[model samples]
Target: MEDKKKFLADLRAIWRGIIGDEGGHCPCCDRWGKIYPRSLNETMARSLVWLAHHSANGDWVDVPKRAPRWLVRSNQLPTLRWWGLVERLDTEDTTKKHSGLWRATKRGLLFAQNRLQVPKKVYTYNAEVERFSDELIAIEDCVGSFDYSAVMESNT
Candidate 1:
């Protein structure tokens, strides 16, 4: 039980570091235009599902690998690989632009098949306002996306 709890906690921490609390948020938007969700939004989930369906039958899959435009444009799907859900196949050439095959890992398969349950959205916690909410906070709650460089080692 303790180990499972620890794993989930560590998951959140790693994702937070890899992504970030204010992922692509407009710091200048003073009016609190919208506090984006801290979980996998519909757009991202759809994209992942698309990948899963195309790569059915456990076959190695190739895809047009590019940082998704909507994710960048909407600031939603930046740090996807950090979740351990999807991975890039290693090609011999290292110095090349992103354009190749990527596959979903076991965890990603679980997610795609709905075996793993993660949160949908988490509310804002403004430290400046000294406020918090404790409804059903889960590991999937995240703000923004980043890369492996942002990964934080879990203190296990």
Candidate 2:
């Protein structure tokens, strides 16, 4: 049930910048689902943020048109639904086959709100990969000295 009257008030007091354009998800922030290494970490982090956002705020609400554009391109929506973080419903909106009707289920809300926890691990392997870093690091003269051959030998 969308309380039209309280919507603005509620958001003003507690908007977490989770909702993206179309207003149906929570975007990643605050390092809630952070994993080192940006290329591989973004999606993982976004999924966690989405779940947590929905779990914390389970209301009949939709994001306004002013939402961020990243949501439109995010794959986490389908991924989350597929993984049961949110429930999907068939919509008659023609523009989309489904997604007209969606709601964060109890499980979604709980997990997102962090009433539960998903056990996980992040192993950081510090290996120096040639002097092949960006200009900033080069300028700073930052170099990690490690035996690359030993690491490669272990893998082989």
Candidate 3:
């Protein structure tokens, strides 16, 4: 009975992001979910840095406020989320705010601030199965600070 209760509690925590049911490499091939440390591209790097600057105070940022339409349509947010750099606001209060809102994860802020170094590459996996996708690579020049001015300049 105690074990069952613990299991149920853990299951509930998954959706809350308190415990992860996703993430971790395959036990057979040992390649899925493998993380590599490659540099980020200018656009991706700038996006992360910019997000970090805005969300450093743990505030959620409006995604579409100044983002280019093309960028919004891109996989930037998903990619960042996959890399654990950013997260979508998922709380009861989320419905009160704009749907397109996000915030940087602690690791994201650290990486954007040049305080943390993460893998540059990672493999996609689906339900313990490795997906047929290209390995991720970091941008060539993403090791420095990217401020508001730089983000705006890139948009122009």
Top candidate on lDDT is: 3
lDDT tens digits by residue: candidate 2, 5-30: 68766763343332211233223233
Better of 2 and 3 by TM-score: 3
Write down the lDDT of every candidate, Cα atoms only. 0.47, 0.37, 0.58
Best-performing candidate as measured by TM-score: 3
> On TM-score, who's better, 1 or 3?
3
How well does model 2 score by local distance difference test?
A: 0.37
Give a tens-digit lDDT track for model 3, residues 1-156: 999999877754553232133445444465444322233455666677767666777888887886656556664765666567889876576556436678778887766655566666544434332222354433323544334454333333
Clashing pairs in 1: 38-142, 79-145
Q: How much is 17 displaced in model 1, in angstroms?
A: 13
- Which ranges of candidate 3 are over 4 A from the true structure? 1-40, 68-70, 73-75, 91-98, 127-156
lDDT of 1 by residue, 33-91 (tens): 23334555556665555455545445555554443555335532233454556666667
Give per-model TM-scores: 0.44, 0.36, 0.52
- Name model 2 segments beyond 4 Å from true: 1-57, 60-67, 93-96, 118-156
